[model samples]
Target: MTTDTASPIPSDAEQFGKPLQGWRLRLYTIIFEADTRAGKLFDVVLIAAILLSVAVVMLDSVEALHQRHGRWFDVLEWCFTLLFTIEYIARLVCVRRPWRYARSFFGVIDLLAILPAYLAALVPELHLLMDVRILRLLRIFRVFKLTEYAIEYRLLSRALANSRRKILIFLSFVLMVVLVLGTLMYVVEGPEHGYANIPTSVYWAITTLTTVGFGDITPQTNAGRFIASLMMLLGWGTLAVPTGIVTAEMTSMRRRPVTTRTCHACLTEDQAADANYCRHCGAKLSPYQYDREEEQPVRR
Candidate 1:
């Protein structure tokens, strides 16, 4: 008797457990998936709009420019805000669970991109927050579909995560050193030398230890100067400690090859190079293809 193997099941579904179809499916494909030409174009245009909006907000801060082009800047700001508002709504409408996505990192960022404009009348200072749209530019990494860059970013992120504990301990030690040195300076230099109190002295200690000598405060006494010299020397070595820790962690990691293929079910990217299913959602992945054109040899 001949036996047949069962075909893989499709797991793409909405929050209500229905498969996405029609316009919603098409919109999701274009908005969430960066693998297609239309999707890439959308992302590029969106990124450009974000950058221009941020520039408008920044230029508005300059008194001279604001006075000269204030009216034009206001119109441009509202135009960009309206565009982002529609994009944000489309993202919500296309996703399976709107509430879930609204609570996600990118979703929050998308909302922030348009919120400042609406609230600009209530609090004029909030208009400056429109610059947060610059964060949306991170989408560029996925839009280009550069597998190597994505892998490197993942590697660096992993190294940093693994080194977090060591880095935290190093920071704690630095904090204690600053506290002790700051108190000692306050006692030796006293209020007359600008080491007015423990907190002020701690600020000086931080600036000195970071080698950022603001020159607003100084150690007048010989004992305080000696301590400052020691802190300065210590800063040089401190700067390299975190770098070495992260580098060592990165070197010990085994780099896995990954693809820019994004999972349709959950919209996760960075799937394993040979994966047939989404690692995050177990959805059967569609055929993976390179977006870039392969070089062809010259014809004889």
Candidate 2:
């Protein structure tokens, strides 16, 4: 009798190795997918660390506090820096396309977040560069829970993109107005009245136009004062125009279809209700069903 002696097929874990299927994949999911429980927990922990690091930086800026707890602050800074370094490395390793993650906006932010500590560690003389660590406050963006409002960000981005030309034109007009007012103020006030030069007058005009009165240079003449008053009034009204434009665009955007199924691959949550693929990354939105009973295993 002829015996069929066939070896068993390898599972997905055995076939592709551990990198794509086991704990590595689980780590990727926790790190990258916000919808999952593990992922949410990971984000919570990350946010807490970010907040503590930011608070440490803020406290270090206070001279009294720095004097008393300088050593503790330094230790905490290094700890937070090390934690972020590990996270950054893990993120780079877990993603299938490390280059893509490295080039992304969050990736750049993450690098900036940890750079100061390393810079300080390598070159103690470069302690001045530690001020760049203030940029870590941008981590508040991740903490504000704004990531959950994908639609608002998308709508606002679209509105801003659409309004860019109009906003540019408005800014150009404002600049021309500033130049004319500055020249007039320089001619009227001259050096004695605190208008030292055309540039200084222009600076005063800008400050008045923006309603940011510094009080270091003020128009002593009736004409200059009148112009300042007019500019202040104009500034108040000018601020409303940009707001109205964005509001109109947002209203128009409300008509578009929206969905809550965030793509685990690219974090693109602004898909349509019926979308089967992510609009941003083209990743599968819905899970695929497999009929394991009818499928034949591959012979090894």
Residue-pair clashes per candidate, as listed? 0, 0
Cα TM-score of candidate 1: 0.67
Best by TM-score: 2
CA deviation > 4 Å runs, candidate 1: 1-26, 121-162, 246-254, 262-271, 274-300
Best by lDDT: 1
Task: Give the Cα-based TM-score of candidate 2 against the true structure.
Answer: 0.67
**Cα lDDT tens digits for candidate 1, 1-300:** 955222322222333122256787778768765665677788678767766777777777777997999999889977987897898898788777788777855566777666666765566664476643343333232222222123355567667777787899999999999999999999999999998899999999999999999999999989999999999999999889999998887776644243558776665666775678999889987664442223233222
Instruction: Put down candidate 2 lDDT per residue, 12-127, tens digits, no spaces.
Output: 22332224455677776677655556777887888778778878877887889989999998898889888988988987877666766677666676777777667656776554
Per-model TM-score on C-alpha atoms: 0.67, 0.67
Distance from true position, residue 85, model 2, in Å? Answer: 1.4
C-alpha local distance difference test of each model: 0.72, 0.70
Report the Cα lDDT for residue 279, model 1.
96
Deviation in Å, model 2, residue 272 alpha carbon: 3.5
